[model samples]
Target: MSSYPTPTLATARLVLRPLVATDAEALFAVFSDPAVVRYWSAEPWTSVAFAEQAIARALDSYRAQSEVRFGIVLADTGALVGTVNLHHFFAQNRRCEIGYALASGHWGRGYASEALEAAIGYAFQGLDLNRIEADIDPRNGASAAVLERLGFRKEGYMPERWFVHGEMADTVNYGLLRRYWNERP
Candidate 1:
């Protein structure tokens, strides 16, 4: 079994923790909303059952040696505000992909950025990753801004890279190396 500790990462206004089965309700609340999933997966969640299944998959990912999923909780209210993950961990390459989403109600508040910063810190300091990447829809200025604010440089644009809503969407790739993080203010 992997020895990764299930620890909570705290930011100024957010708490990042592993997803528990009991989080299904909160996950459903965020994911079932059309706005929240618009730029994420291909389809919006239709029921709480989908959230349950997703939670199950998250649990499985946690059990694996290469992935970590975290639920973003509001520090003040303790509400499940979003989710973030580090996946495709490459031991040989010392790299990983970072993905995140926040509830519609939580958007525009910097919660996603705060949660992502914590995740990045964990990846670099805790996991000793050398590089981190985020793939975002080309039109998602907010997400792009988050990556940029966190010192990720836009590396490329992949045309028709992801299929969403029955149409192929272009994706922008952003990446930050350990040296980049070290040079940040």
Candidate 2:
């Protein structure tokens, strides 16, 4: 039996579930796009091996019950779109961090927002978590906007927190409390 069978989260158009080895190709397609990863903490993946390694790590984390990463897919065609993750678990405090990515081809649509909603709902309800946090490059306006739309408030800013690909970037922190999420209109 699986240590943590990642529950499937579905909306009208998307399905979020645990990634399998077979998803490596689609996963590589999403992360290998420069446009999709421009503001990401890591640079674009160079090979399918990166996706394979990531799935390997995700599987290990799942078995250890340390992190939950969900692959976002289109419901109609079951095509991989992106991913949403809840990691850095502080079980004693009932808290974790949220992160997500989407293919550039799916940009301008509400896929990220929809997928995040499902993931956040799972974190708070299914996992019984109290707080979820996120830190993103301030230049990622779209990501900040999505977190805001999901009721995550900007909490702090850290300058030059990351030096990825020889570029220094500032981070804006966001946090959402379960009570606040419960109170959303």
Candidate 3:
């Protein structure tokens, strides 16, 4: 696999940058909320320590060339609203997966869409990735709509791909190709 760089990216109203140690408190506020993490693959974080640990791991993974995650910060308030992640890279195939968790308060406001669109652009144009994929909970209509608007087509559904919160959860897989993305309206 090729080592890719994680550089800062800016959208109209948000900034996609690396998470820092100082962001722990704000990160905890977002990840520890049950509502924010309700549909996420991981359980709601219990403490600020979780955020600290996650940031550290994210940085380490970046150095290890395995995964990369960006902290979603509102440009105006300079608040850490959530994260946009692009990981599970396959350099040979030019494919990767994207995931995110925005603060519940920021949902319905297009922050996730803006950040994701920027990230997708970087994945394709910057890293030269040909394909980007997302595995979301089928129940998440909001995420489904976002993916659709971004030109990702729902290609498959897995009945029990993840065991979350003591239950078998389904996954809706979405994909977008470079050629299609380049021609997106």
Candidate 4:
């Protein structure tokens, strides 16, 4: 059986669910925006084809029992504003990495934090995970703030860990153990 089964998760204003091929256009728009993906580990997606392939890869990740990437849908309009993810599942260690990217237009609206809270709750409760880690570029203060608010503590840092946008950047690692996680259903 797959360790990660995509489930419908709901919050006050958003629904976290599996991405489908039909969501390609909307997802592409979110990913194609440079501002949205500036701090992302990967470069900005440039085509709808990439979004389609990404959805396929997400399913493959679940099939392999390694990860889950859920599209964050607005509860009222059902518009896909972003994605919340738990990846690099380490079953033996009972750990995983959590991440997200929201459409630029949705920034400062509390969407990412709300969606991530629900996703992390799923990791700790639904999946029985022991720890969740987040790696962010040290310069991305906004993301750092979100991680901090979610009760993740800075665990470490690696200098020049990633080469992005033609430059090297340091990475800050934050972590939260199930015992330390504060959010609840």
| Global lDDT of each candidate | 0.86, 0.91, 0.90, 0.89
> Which stretches of candidate 2 lie above 4 Å from their native place?
1-5
TM-score of 1: 0.95
TM-score of each: 0.95, 0.96, 0.96, 0.94
| Shift of residue 43 alpha carbon in model 3, Å | 1.6
- Global CA lDDT computed for model 1: 0.86
Query: Which candidate gets the maximum lDDT versus the true structure?
Result: 2
- List model 2 lDDT by residue over 34-98, tens digit each: 88888777889999999999999989987887788999999999999899999888878889899
RMSD of each: 1.5, 2.0, 1.1, 1.8
- When 2 and 4 are scored with TM-score, the better candidate is 2
Q: State how far residue 51 of model 3 sits from its true place (Å).
A: 0.6
> Per-residue lDDT tens digits of candidate 1, residues 32-132?
88888788745888889998998888878767644778999998998897899888777778888998889999889889888888999888999888999
Query: What shift in Å separates residue 91 of candidate 4 from its native position after superposition?
Result: 0.7
The Cα RMSD in angstroms, rounded to one decimal, for candidate 2 relative to the true structure is 2.0
Give per-residue CA lDDT, model 4, range 56-100, as digits (tens).
Answer: 998787677668789999999999999988988888898989889
Q: Which stretches of candidate 4 lie over 4 Å from their true place?
A: 183-185
Write down the RMSD of candidate 3 (Cα, Å): 1.1
Weakest 10 consecutive residues of candidate 2 by summed lDDT: 1-10
Error of 4 at 12 (Å): 0.7
Q: Write the per-residue lDDT of candidate 3 for residues 1-185, one digit (tens) a residue.
A: 58877889988899999988999999999999998877777899988999999999998987886777999999998999999889989989999999898999889999988999999999999999999999889988999999999999999999989987778899999999998888887
Candidate with best TM-score: 3
TM-score, model 3 to reference: 0.96
